[model samples]
Target: MGRLPLGVTTLALFFGTQATTGSLETASTVSAAAMIGMAAGAPLQGQLLDRFAKPVVIVCFTVLQVATFVALAVAVNGGSATWTLAVLALCQGMTIPSLPSCTRLVLKRAVSAGEVDAAFALDTTLMEVIYVSGPAIAAGVTATWGPQGLFLGCAVLVAAGTIFFVRVTGARWLGPDPGQAERAPDKEDLRPRPHDSRHWLPAGGFVLAMALLAAPFGLIECALTQFGTEQGTGLSLTGLILSVTGLGSIAGGLAYGTVRWRTGPARRFVVLVLGQGAAITVVAVLPSLGVVWTGLTLAALCTVPLASICFHMLDLLSPPGIWMRMQSWGAVANTGGHAAGVTLGGYIATAYGSGATFALVGLCAFLAIMAAMPALLNPSVRRPEPAKVGAHAE
Candidate 1:
């Protein structure tokens, strides 16, 4: 539900801007404007869900998100000036549902820890499909109707998903509705203590891990875009490369879910983190477009396994009662990292060439490993206790 719009909007950002302005620079500004809202909203949304009823939190934001997005579609397609469009973009982000956090929250309650890997894997694979199809759908819609149609379609889908989600809760199958108030308060407070020095480390570590993990992704995406530019195929090759990578992600995520790794998660995390770096190196050093493409695909393939492991680790390690907030913090890390990666990668690609970005990305992943080392090494934090019966609120 969240992904439908996210995937479409990623590609639609360009189409929406160019539909009126016809400038890449202007397109970037528009995209950044949208990012501003998403960046500001996602963590806050996560915190709200942790503090309130899941349905209540989602309904509040979904209504606002839908309204803002519809208005944004109008503003962009109606040939409103860039500043107006930027304001609309911010509004859209502010109200967006922060679906990633919500979905993960649902999954946590839906499946046992043992079952979670498979659930996440299935979701990740579906997400890859969405990532591919969403852009294609947007492109087709834009080519036939206009950017306005593309956004309208996305807005409608998002609204439908939200509505369906709420109705399902009324039936009462998986997720709890009354939310966090029933939880044991001694353990589950949403608000953090300033004097709780131990809490601060985990917060910083989670953010750092998420940010570093995502940073390279952004840098590599830019590198791929630049590769297409160098090849004179414009943006066509970029999509092809991304599609191949998405396939790789699907494969890796499925495999990771299938195998129960014997090693402690922390150790496996280090290896996976290092593997991600190696994947980048493979793409960087390899010659021949075919080989390079394969390497990039392999790189994408490595992505989800690491993320899955990290997510599982987070689930195991988060303090009771505030898991949703921790998840939201991780979300913040990813959003911030991706944004930083794009800015840094664009600068590096401009000055040092696309090839240089591979090294930069690998370096960031390496740093992530370093940031994660302390947590990973703590034997006490390795895995969580058995599932408790009363964790979920009625």
Candidate 2:
């Protein structure tokens, strides 16, 4: 609920603004501002998790999100100026805290070491479901009920998600309380301790792997839209393509959950990367809408499995105290990769064309496979204990 409603509203606001103002450039600027705001606040939000109880932080951010949505609803209704739009976008961005942080906090406590992989796979699958459902709902609601309805619905959804999460997780008290296991040593702590530097190498590797895997996806959205347009459909059909890809992502995530692979996670990551690179390369050769659609679907399928591997690795490798922050950092890597990919993709698409852009993304995916090879060879990847010989070598 924390994600779905906000996701719906963000789409509604974005496309709704496009519908209202008929300015794609302006809408893109607005969305970029919001995303930049979200990215900038990510680390600081993680720092808050480092200091506060997970529940308190989640609740506080939810309230702020709702208030901002309410204000956004009013402003959009009143036909606010561009400055108003930019400010509200920034507000929305800052209030969108790191979701993986909260999820990591709960999972770190709930699951045993043996079950961590399954738990994180479940989490990744659920997020895939959300990605599929959110935008579809956004398209439906914005077309029918308008942006005002979208905002009101989002406000309610966020409120309920926060309440439900707190109840289920038994996080009633704020901050560190008695008997909580969160007092374990974190990566940021000054005091020297055993677990302090233990998981650094695996965690760093996990972050890098995620960043590499995310590169193509950032560019794919734009290229896919162009593909749709080239097939004689207008830009509006891009939503349908994205929705279809989301379904494939859902299937891939579920498949990852069910498969009981014997290979270690690092090796599994390499396999997933190979599949992703191959699928993305197919996108470059699609000659018709049907073929492009199939290619996009397969590529999305590749994405979810890679995401599951990365999150599961982080969960296994992170210390209990800094699990939330480690997850946040992973998210930061994904965000940074997306940003860089989008910038590069835009330049390539403009200068050469979407076909060239698709080829470049495929090349990036192939490069990701090579980038992860070293980690796959390391026996200590996702090891629970620090290597005595490489204690200082992250």
Candidate 3:
């Protein structure tokens, strides 16, 4: 429910802006503005979520997000200037509820260490499903009722989802109660010490890795659209290919979750990243659409597992107090990477070709590996024990 509305909102913003202004460039800039805002706001919001109660933080942001959406819709329809629309879109992105980060925290608290992989896999798989269905629903809503209706529908859906989430999870499980501390005396010891700077290295590395992992996706998406246009295949075919990619992600995530891995997350993550890079590089070089479809699907198979492992590592490594913030940083890195990649990919596709845009995928993977080597080599970065029962609250 929380994420479902986002697809509608995104499409509504792009198409609504373009329809109103009659400028494709302006619409793209407006969309990029929102991505920028999201990247800028994620870490700050994470801190807020960490410092405050979950229900309060979520409720506050959801309301702000919905208001921004309505305001943007109104402004766009009113024939507002490009600057005005961009500012509103930025605000809308900034206020989006940090539900995914919160959910990961909840999962970490609720599950055992051994089960964390599977739990994260389920979360990733659900996200893939949401991505698959959300856009199709958005397309239908736009066709029937137009962008305005889509905007209104998104607002209602978000509000409903937020209310339900808070009522179900917030009331029953507030942040760590006094009893929790008594039950888990060693919790403080398990936490990363403030004085140990070494503990933060992995976090930095993880953020870089996440950014690199996401860049390929953004680049490929833009490149594919360009490719479709050049081939006269149109947006429908592009959308279909992306949907198929999502299916591959779902399959990979589900399979990864059920299995018990012999290797640690660090090793597995490295292998996946390298493999994804190679697959994409090969796919990009091929001129045939059939090969593009098959290659992209094969490459996409790594994405969800990579995400699941990253979250699992965070749960295992980060201190309890700042875990939410760390998760938020991950979100920030991803948003930033996608935004950058899209911008760069557009230029590359226009000047060079769509195929050339994909070559960046391999380069990003290589850079990410370099950036992560320090943390990956650190002896202190080992798998830790699972959370003690009742050690934390939602």
Judging by TM-score against the true structure, name the best candidate. 3
**What is candidate 1's lDDT per residue for 1-394, written digit by digit as tens?**
6568877775676777887788888778887887777778777876676666777778888888778778877887688988887787777767777566566656766776556655666666676677767778888888897877777877888888988877765324224422332244444343334355665565567569878998987898888877677668778888788877877887888877666444566776777778778878776676347766877777777788777666666655565556666666776677788999998999887787777887788888788977876567555345532333544311
Prediction 1 TM-score vs. true: 0.86
Clashing pairs in 1: 188-321
Which stretches of model 2 miss by more than 4 angstroms? 172-208, 229-241, 285-294, 369-394
Better of 1 and 2 by lDDT: 1
Best by lDDT: 3
Tens digits of per-residue lDDT, candidate 2, 128-244, equal 787677777887887788777787788888888778777887553334421135565545432223265635654566577677667677687767666666666767677787877
Candidate lDDT values, in order:
0.71, 0.68, 0.76
Taking the tens digit of each residue's C-alpha lDDT, what string does model 3 give over 1-394? 8777655566667887887788999988888888778878888887787677768988999999889878876786688999999999899888889878767766755777656777888898888787778777877876787667777777888889888877877844546422232145354444345446877876688788788877887799888988898889989878889988999998999988777664666787789889988888886788578878877888889889988887766655565556667878888887788777887888888898878887888889888878777656643334433444654311
Once fitted onto the true fold, the runs of candidate 1 whose alpha carbons sit more than 4 angstroms away are: 170-195, 227-236, 384-394
Write down the lDDT that model 3 would get. 0.76
Inter-residue clash pairs, candidate 3? none
